[model samples]
Target chain A: MGNDALNVEHSSGHSAAVFRETQDSEQFRRLKRKHRGFVLPVTAACLLWYFTYVLLAGYAPDFMATPVFGRVNIGILLGLSQIVTTFAVTMIYVSYANKQLDPDAAAIRDRLETKEGVR
Target chain B: MLHLAVTAPAAPGDPVLNIAIFGLFVAITMVIVFRASRNNKTAADYYAAGRSFSGGQNGSAIAGDYLSAASFLGIVGAIAINGYDGFLYSIGFLVAWVVALLLVAELLRNTGKFTMADVLAFRLKQRPVRIAAAISTLVVCFFYLLAQMAGAGGLVALLLGINDRVGQSVVIAVVGALMILYVLVGGMKGTTWVQIIKAGLLIAGAGVMTIWVLAINGFNLSTLLDSAVETSGNPAILAPGLQYGLSDITRLDFLSLGLALVLGTAALPHVLMRFYTVPTAKEARKSVVWAIWLIGIFYLFTLVLGYGASALIGAERIAAAPGGANSAAPLLAFELGGSVLLGIISAIAFATILAVVAGLTITAAASFSHDIYASVVKKGNPAPGAEVKVARRTVVVIGIVAILGGIGANGQNVAFLVALAFAVAASANLPTIVYSLFWKNFTTQGALWSMYGGLASAIILISLSPVVSGGEKSMLQGVDFAVFPLSNPGIVSIPLAFFLGWLGSVLDKKKESLEKQTEMEVRSLTGVGAEKSVAH
Candidate 1:
């Protein structure tokens, strides 16, 4: 099995071998766990915001239209807020993921490459 | 249902001005179509722009395809008449992309080669799952395509002063022909560029219109509100309609509609396919971020148009027009910018329909060719070039089906059909896709059960809804009650699908373990599981 693995690795090239061998690695497990944390909260927040707009527009029409401006209603404000929420969520996610998640994943990747060199 | 009175008598033949405008649009589209053909090459080139689209370019095309006639025309008209409730739809659409970005985009890019069915059925024995996914894809795409075609026909009739049927058939034929040429000649590369350019122009036009609208209202949000309030005869411009305002029922309906819009985008086969155009999962993520920004800005402009329509043209005038509130934006443009700008705006609307319908057609073709024909029927032995050829042929077949569906359902009530499509998408596709990507225990049986269950339930409920059953007029109208209110099944069906998927997965755990070998299939898909299992 080990020889077969090496032969397949030789044929497909190093990157493929690394990708295959890392499937059950601690690094992959950690990345997947981190991704879950990020994705769940973000998705939940978006869904919550979406429902809030709809609920406010439907049930509290008067409150939504509480007249921020002359004729601009609360519905319009909430509706437009959807656009703001989209960008806010996106920017926050990108910055956080790049700063926190990517570096950790990168460190693991470097370790894997160095291990491959030792092998 | 409103018919134009045609206040002015017909002066002579062909309405020369209308002919000139229509002719010019056709001429330009043809030139662009042929020029785009120059980029077409292999099957990959046809389906995914040769996987060469930069994040920004694909993002623009995604925005273009996403902003259908519904967003550009329907939301504006809805806002013009319904005020705040109308803008709710735009907000729902914009926020939906968040789901696309965080949950579906990177996963879809990593999993599937071409079609969404490929992603869903990735770990499963492909045949049954592929067949079911393909059917759902075709059904959803067909319904959506019909709505686009009908919108095209209506837009032409509204703009050119022609018989509605004649206008519709012309649009059907023209769009069908162009879509076929787009797939057969231009492929994905051409399609992407066309989508990108169209999206850019559409956004620019919306921005221009928004600025003009605010300028007309002197950029005073309060004054604009006062004018809208005065014009609308409602104290608040955002209040609910004559029928639905100040009611719990209406509020629930609004929330359901929003849920459908936000969740449905992640599930849409065509929209999901666009993420694959980017090279890596990282680029896929970046493209979605860009798409969110572009779509957000464009929707904000929609709010301006909605308010602008009421302030400038009067809601009553819009309500009285042939298509009722839907014509508000175009009419407002005519009043604000005169005939030339009206012509330009109208032309852009027409272009919007073509570009969207074309994207839908290509996605549908890929689903049929890749999922059903190659994967399921042929057991993945598609002889390399055979799959692409099959895909091109499917484009023509699907295009014809869409044209026919449009004609059959032409005047029957298109708005209702479109809402139903969104409902079905949110219910059937969203749950299955999300579970597959995120849930490790999601079994083939669970996916199959949830997808078919969601698809069947939404379709049945919609068919029995007041919108389709004609309210009080039909024989079963009194007895056959709508399972869900708001005529859209997203609220009920989406949750139902998720529950079913969870139940199926939980109950079938022992059987699921029998297929533990499938965990290795994930590596084949994400390039992670394959190496460990395949000795490579």
Candidate 2:
């Protein structure tokens, strides 16, 4: 929506104006809210989990070293779990995006490009 | 440099066989690139393969590009010697991918074109942000390329038993020339295909070694772990004290390293650039999912490969090798499968470098052509077909520079070199992405400050921080002028980079910088008016 920069000679002023208009549009705001709704809490939780593992490894060596099985200890279990958690989070995000975020985003795009015929 | 540190210059592995395997892989990659270039018609063709890749294919290609010699060779070797500490890197690298996939990848794909600058300048003032981003991309790409080049030279020399500078330079030159050809001819399409082949070969090679390791330990993971701890002869390895647990300072260093690895992988320019190779934002997300699976499986296999090397080869022997732990995999190959297997693994390692440097060369060339030449110099009026020509020329310049840098860095501890790149990416590029995507208040001034400040601080810290100027292990040798305590700079520079960005935006109340925040937000989220797929 910001200035069609490829052809526009004075793109700065025009680009900023286009975005200011988009900023005021209700559909843009709703689309952003939906994206933020799903993304924020998930990212926050993942970071917290990641840091806890890293901090435990850094500061609580004893906790990390506590024996879970014979030679397999708590630290190694946690480390492997980190890999497992990454896979789970990815699947969760992808499924959530497919079900919730993608449809609404596609709708917004269609409204812009086809309904309103905005370039 | 990392490989040379592990293995001494013993008689090289097998010149005739190594060369044969190396020649075969190189010749095939060249043919792929040569054929792909015939279809090249525009900047989009040169840069994003005309957005032709499906999610799964792009995913495989991303894995090929991301899994450089560092992950394939360095981390496995590091773990063989360092125990859980070595796999810590694997965790950091993987977790970072997850973070980027969930939060960043689609946005990058939906917003950016061929380079990081496209995304950064989406909302901010265009010229200044592009300039800052080009510099940051160049800095990150240069160091990463240098490390790959040096690693390739050392791996080849050690494998082929080449002892002198002449032999090593030949290795460096051949690699440089091949990579130049890939970028000049293949553009993104050829490079992506080469990366796919490399990823497949790497996975197969690593999978074989892991299976061999598991077979040796009777396929029981616990037994393998126990044997690893026992054979290591260092009880501390089973715990966390071997690599970074010695003292309080080292512990801080460990945390800093963790921060760098986790954030660094997300910010890597080449890795982010891969998202553009696919067309739709959905494909972008799928590409990341595919990368997670491939990278997840690959890293898990690396754990087995690492411990297997230790249990099978013994700690002292791995230490004694000229390349240190870097020789663990090849040595393990030879132990399990004899000379033929070792030769194959070495050849796979060479292919790994070729794919990685090709990816890096193109990314660097894009930063030069798209960011610097098209966006900055041409002032957004790039004529049709002009950008790709400049890109081809840029590839030659980068290839030559990398060859020289690699030759200069040969035989040094290139281990930490990649870490420095990660730190720069984390400190500089990550902030730029986060701010541009999330921060409504982010201005052009803030973007520039963050990019340059993070880049400069990372380089300065790394140069002074024992990696370059410390003791015998340091590149500077006997004279120790290293004042920076930790080798990794993430704990300091990353926060500083973010802070500078926030402060600069707050200070520079440019009304225009705030105006496009919503437009960038909408477009990045919903892909309105994003570059449509160019029909083939």
Candidate 3:
């Protein structure tokens, strides 16, 4: 209800048409592809890694219990690695988004907002 | 369950010192909240703190909001008693941020205005989607509040040596009242400040204790573990299965709980609502990064503290304490620095409850006011200031309800309540949000089906699960209605909700308008039109 862009859609349909055009544009397609392409696989891989750890902790206690270093077993190491991987993935995504995603998004956003003068 | 009869050790620290520290914290946060609330004249200010918080600040608040007493006291206590099994929970909770950061945060920040409903209802039929989202939000908040409230009763009673039920109930009421005051006076702005302050104190307190614990063992983690092993007389604690490895059924239950904890964070309504307090999608991303680091580091501290507690105080004492495993951190504090340290840590724990409850209350209030009252009840045309007024009233109503519910649930094995809240959020909210954000073909019918069906299945399964009735530690005594084996319904309900969402969308012949979908997609991905609406 507070959205002028949505209100514009109901009133004139011009902004809606423009939105559809932008949605179909090659740049927008590229943006979506780049964003989802990185996010989806990374998400799947991280989740797979995490669930694998969970399962090992559940079903394979002996393997996890195999002492890796003094008093620290594979389970403790694996748990620590999950934390490491979380921080690693977060940093990777931040850099990736900063370099690969934001500029394209800003360009697309600026063009639309400038044309509509919604601000 | 047999451990319920174990009397707690003579009160660990000075109760007078604990009360003094608690009073000091309450007074300081109250002043900050009142000062911060001066600018809250509009609905946006009330709900989103005028989008004034930086990424790092919001990150601290997020960490504060996310790290309930359950994580601080509960996980540490778990590790103290159960060892490696307790560490699994920390891993699951930390890894959950990946899902939030990569999939939900930025796009949601771009698409929505106030609550999770704003994102889900963006391209769909607004009223139905908003109503459904509001219901799920309220339910999740209510359950989470119940857990915190029950924890508050047991925790404060244990600290102050109040053995009477009347004293515990009074403590719960006072917590509820303080929560109401924070939200009523500070709104999101005040609540966020409380969260920030609490997060700092919590992390700092944990960090000091962690260093102290490591120092006691000559800075050797292995030595600490060795001492813990010696003291507990169980090297099995160093390995998994001390808790969850007894049988295949418990193992499978661990898996279910893991599934819920990992997938649950992004869909949590209070957490989602925090994303709106930041200025941009990039800032939202930054906040998650900040939160992951702060929370991840905090959990790492919990691991040390847990091992330290087991090493110093021994597992038997922790398990036999008044609050059971939830007293591990406090006990460790008493061990390290006597009554003063114990007082400070206990006060931090108390602030943890107050801040978390305040966050939940404000979020639920916003949902009811913005989604249910303003959008649905007013038919999207309420007069100026009406929404904020409604939100204040809703906060009062929710506070009273939470007080009553907390008292009713006090002294019960309500740890399952928090897990149930996670299950509901993961099942009832996550699927629809993912579909709406990614799938252009998602419809109103699909949203309704996913939200309502997911909610119903989660509630139903929880009621029938061992957590509610059949088990020795269930909420109900001497009743054997539990047919479901897994305590958490997530492993079943999460996939079911996703399946129902896909099925409903596929079956619907009536599709949402393409123009609206385009607007949402463009707006969500690029942040266009979002700032125009959210800015002023």
Candidate 4:
């Protein structure tokens, strides 16, 4: 998969010639481009949420200390917030990758299958 | 009508509730250990969970091992007594997880098999490097184990009403026995499960305490602050600086401790080894994310427990106890939640010590058997099952040594001992690990120099610091020692380690073809290169 992506870049300028001579396909290029965005953003968002939680605890002690229930301090709320954040980030990433990135990567993968079939 | 104060005499009883709670905890642990033993077959199974844990499970175990007695109890106690300064350790510890997530977790998981020395000596062809790393690993683990054992003793004494020495001895014997079982029977599988279960119970208990604390404070920010301020004589309970006796310098020292905790957690031999229990690098990453949530929540509860201790139990009581501020959380449980809750909390504390110490013992054993004995002395090949037997034997020796250390250090402040361990770890181990991972020119010579330099410098600085030097019984009590101002050595040692590592790497760049070796090393570490090359 990585080899195909690298080859696509190397053959971009000679797309017409390469497409004719080699089993280079349009679907594979699009798929590789699509999946590239999935991992980086998901990782970044998770880290961001984590740091934000830390910063909030460090800076917003008063707001965090505000008890929502009898004796339930704000720190508990902030701490529990990480659970929500983790789930939220993870769910969003999985959904986004499934909906957006994986299909594209799969399409490119299918193109390889068809190319191999032709050969 | 004025009610005159009547002094109540100290009440003495059989502490039946405490005994029952402790007995139940032991029974449960034994069941788990015995069950784990059923699955123990190969040495790999004993040492690395047969390398089968998912990222999340290992992550929890990491959290379990990482959240020590000091973290679970001492931080809360410190916060209760010293206010925001005390909470700094939690923040530091949490940030260190971020370090683990980003840099060390996956890398170490990918590089090492059982011990950290395996990773350190992967590229370097030096017996001295492996020996040095093993020694450092043992030293750090022993100090950490001593702190945990002492904590266990304190917990037992507090709950069972036994004399401190008896409590210490019992904890030593029980933990030693349990750890030996963990190694001989379940191995990594048993240890990992113990850590996971303990982490769960610990967080759940802390969560319960947090809810209780908030409920007692009426869930009112203003009211909570007002009460804390009124009781504490410092209205700045809501703000960072509103607390007393906390100056800028002290705050920075607290921050240094925090940095040490976070970074130190990643460097800890036991905690780092937990990552290797998983099969793949991706799982290792996933487990860390899980650990982040567990650790973050536990630390958050610690903040509440700290404030709760001050607001409800009063700082005076916390200070008056034999353990001083460190006893605040346990004491608060006793006062607020009654004996039942106290019993549970104390049992959980005991479990915390046992789980952490068991992890430490296993790591120390691995270092001794795998790194020093098998790899260094025997040149990496030994008779079948011999290494495993040696590891089990080493566990007994290490456990005994830890007990003696715990006994010698009993009645001393645990927070100081833990902090010293962190300082030493941050100084000695972290630099070597980070340099080896990232720096291309990190030769065996560089690793050797950095490890010894950081170790020696941290020891000297700590000996000269106020924590040891200014004490009445200190060797340097009457002598003038110009160590750094802060009692903790993180600020000095961390930077010093980095400098030594960098300097050594730079000087040795010409001695070897570092770039070529580092390229191959990175490929192996990342699992990006060919598999056949990796086997070599």
Candidate 5:
């Protein structure tokens, strides 16, 4: 896979041609699919949950004020839940990337770098 | 500035002790910064710390950079005075990190070398895009600097009882000089160390205060809340809407504020620049994880401290203090352990401002030198070692400007400056960044349109909003030209930016280079070619 003739300026169109080949490869596509598959929905869901909380805090103050237990109300509980959700999502993403995403990405990188004589 | 009924100007603690502790902190960090700057030989060394920091170290620095005086002091004071409503800000700030971790951080680290401009200019027309990014970066940094500087002035006034206008101005100048020295000597490597030390001290101090507050209430959270409500004589303190629930318009303002906070963190220039300090994308990811935990735990501490302050000192006295609500934490420190704790905690607050301003100054300097001077003016070829020298000079200029602005803004409500910075970042930078990374058809024209359009609209809206004019608490006193109903512009400007990006790309007949786009996509998704540049 080593092609001495293909080595040129990193930003030139010739090197980008090699990157284009990697971009179209099945391995590269699979890595992108895996990444977007995990990240997109998780991001949308978190944003949705966050906005819902914000809207309720803004518009439905009465609901947010409803007491849950003793002094803890719906607003306080919902706020704490947001904290929990944030930490949980971070851990989930990290674990998911470690198990599902990183290996495929690393393999694809190895192939690209080796072909480009970057070893 | 609206004059709140203030308690008499009496120093809360031993002023001499506070000054001595603060002096010690400055002397120690200055030594560390001097040691770190010895390695600043290349542009990479000056800008990204030679990509030398581990994930954990970078994470701690990121937490330090991200948690400005706004997060530490402002949010703490907000919660102490306004009850549940104040906690909302912490939630927004924290949740924004999820957007950063999942969407922005690793991809950015893999793609960009030093500044945010490196990524945005990667596939677009370098000259126009780089200039737009540098301008947006400088504006955001200046706004944030003003907030921190003004907060410093107020913090010192309350902590040491320096009430005269001239004394506050001198304090601002001294802080400016220290920030200049940190960046001039340490560069990014030194700045990162200062941030790390500050983060540790800040979290530790807040943790101590949180535990002390909890113990006094028998370690029961409900007991703390009950005491807060009982002391304040307002049961509404336990619920939402004390701050933002006055009317329908005020409620809408809360939504706008929430929108800005959630979207703003990922786009903030200084915050985004922190990703480059780590060598690999994996380290970037790990750094974000560490940052989320550290920042999350710190916010939790603030919650207890907020209600703790209300419970211990009563809301009336906190409201009546010299800096108004900003005085809560220092006042609570005085109440908790008398002068000694007050001295220590106040010194920590000063350290927070110093760490943050140094971070901002270096970031702005990097933007000016890397984007404007080297890339744009020199047309991408400068004499060896010229870039770092230019950066050092830019730091001095920024320090002077910040001192002047801080002195002018002293005693004003600096909160809106922070809000404006966030809104501009969310509206201007975030859309362009997302498009360049995710949208293949994103053209140079689209990038330019979104960057300039979003920046102008956000700034114009904020300037005309109630934050700057009209109402009693506005920055400009006794003016009524505020046509924008919402105090924050994010709800409107963010969507507009995204739309402009799409429309501009579609309208342009000439498309951006497909090869460049493909290259960027591959580089960002995988770590190929990223590590080599980072190592350089």
Candidate 6:
């Protein structure tokens, strides 16, 4: 395997022991709650948005037919916006990770590894 | 089934340029595979690309892997034939990335290494879940591969001037042989580089086609749409009635197809396997972001390519081509750009198939060697190189089966098969992923039930659906054998699979271990105690 960290696991149980400790820590629980709080609402919102577009396309042909501009109907406009929406949402989450999630998460990692190293 | 059993369309020139372009693409790809095979000394090197890929490279590779011939040829062909309805597929396919990028990538990265089996078996009882995971992965891969192989066989015949069935069989054999070699020797790194290069070429090639199409129409989309509506004689060129909203069955069918495309993309085993190629969860997320961008752009261009085909060549002529509407893209290339451009476009489409085939082959090989053979068959202690050896042999077997299957299928449209593949992925894989990662109470019983339940229901529903049973559009079209109302089964099978998973977990009454859940959560969230990479 190309993983030195994984190879070491068979010789010594250090990573597993460290993981057990990290799992028991309050910080871990906090991280889980924060992540769930962010991810669940986003998932729900995305699914809801996607289904709305699909359901509209399936059930309401006239509404989709109404053109917003000359020869550019509402359906075409809405379809194009789906691409825009994906990009916008992905960028939002990426920014959220950069600004909110990664920093705190990295701190927990560094602290746990240092304690393990000292031990 | 390879639709368009008829010969390739009558382009102005003979097959000289197309063959040359295709040969050049194959030669360059072989060089890449040769370089990549040298690094395949260890399991990680073979499977994860030594975790050496930068986020940008992996991201492009992901896009390449995700956008198969279906996106390039299928969607365009659908649009050319069905007008506005074909464009709806682009919306559904792109929307799927939102789920993959925001919700799934982090969890997949935290626990998964090598395969989706890695993620599912992370906290669950390993053996049963791994076995179930491997089986479902293979099933999905098999169907997906069959679709790709059929499409590739048809494509090869178009490019090489192969007229007879025997010639098509030879083409399938050659494709199968090359794909097997890439997986058996070059591994994921080789497959990935090929995908990245193909993605670049596809984007560039499609970009030029889109621009030239617009140039023909004086850079006005409405002009193109107007010509499309007029030529196609489909008033619903910019409306829903052309493809969907016609009848109750079609409406439901559209809904089901939309559901599968929107949900099934992330669940695809090959696409998911790309996640582990990067080093960290952050890189995985970024890779997804990149993929969404590229795929989104590619599909946007497809809008022009599809509509433009109707606008220029007229949808009737495109539909008249062998393989029906799928020839729209190639026909468009022939009409506007002549034989030279058609040759390049054909080469790119062929590369798209090859890159995807290589990706699928590697994932199947990984699932077999890592998930089943090493983890299940050998009880997690494989002899040195035994797993890799098994992986190599599996690739040969899969390649041969795929080639034979391609030859066996009568020429029919395989676009529906891609949708069915996605439906299977959504049904069989997605529920397991969602429940295992998020639901703390999710048990091994639940995981097994979801995978098997989803797999069986998807196959059963698809067998009963019109795609396999109804008319010329159906596998058994002439005789009325289909009892299922819809063509795709995601509308029914997906919800059933999720419910089965929930019911199984609730009923199992397995001993709850909060610590195990906590371990997975901590590692998944903070990226601590996750699998690590060592440079080769």
- Could you say which candidate leads in lDDT? 3
Q: What DockQ number belongs to candidate 1?
A: 0.35
Screening candidate 3 with a backbone cut-off below 3 angstroms (N, C-alpha, C), the clashing residue pairs are none
lDDT values of the candidates? 0.71, 0.82, 0.89, 0.66, 0.87, 0.81
Candidate 3, residues B273-316: lDDT per residue as tens digits? 99999888888999999999999999999999999999999988
Query: On a 0 to 1 TM-score scale, where does candidate 5 land against the true structure?
Result: 0.97
Over 4 Å off in model 5, which ranges? A1-9, A12-14, B1-7, B531-536
TM-score of each: 0.89, 0.95, 0.97, 0.79, 0.97, 0.95
Q: Per-residue CA lDDT of candidate 1, range B1-536, in tens?
A: 22344462221123345446645755665677677666555555667766777788889989988898878888888888877667667777888888888888876775566777767776555677778788888878888888887766666566655554766687668767776776666666666766787788789888988999888778876666667777877765556543346466665665666677778878888888887777766677788998989998988888788888988878888877655666787788777877766676776777777778888888888888877777766766667688789888988888788777766655555566567677788888888887776777887788878888889988887776666565653324446565454567777888998898888778875444323223323332233211111010
Ranking by DockQ: 3, 2, 6, 5, 1, 4
Pick out the ten consecutive residues of candidate 2 chain B with the lowest summed lDDT: B3-12
Instruction: At residue B308, give the lDDT of candidate 6.
Output: 91
lDDT of 2 by residue, B102-184 (tens): 77899988877888888888777777788888888888888888889888766765677776778888889988888888888
Looking at candidate 3 chain B, the ten consecutive residues that score lowest on lDDT are: B1-10
Model 5 is docked with a DockQ of 0.48
Candidate 3 has a TM-score of 0.97
For candidate 6, lDDT tens digit of each residue in B441-515? Answer: 998888888889888988898888777877667776567777888888999989988998898899988844565
Backbone clashes under 3 angstroms, per model: 11, 14, 0, 14, 0, 6
Question: How well does candidate 4 match the true structure in TM-score terms?
Answer: 0.79
Quote the lDDT for A69 in model 1. Answer: 60
* Recovered fraction of real interface contacts per model: 0.47, 0.58, 0.64, 0.03, 0.66, 0.61
Rank all candidate structures by their lDDT, best first, as comma-separated numbers. Answer: 3, 5, 2, 6, 1, 4
lDDT of 3 at B270: 98
The ten-residue window of minimal lDDT in model 1 chain A covers A1-10
Q: In candidate 6, what are the lDDT values of residues A1-119, reduced to their tens digit? A: 11222223522434545666776677766776677788789878888888888888888888999977778999888888878878888888888879878887898877865766511
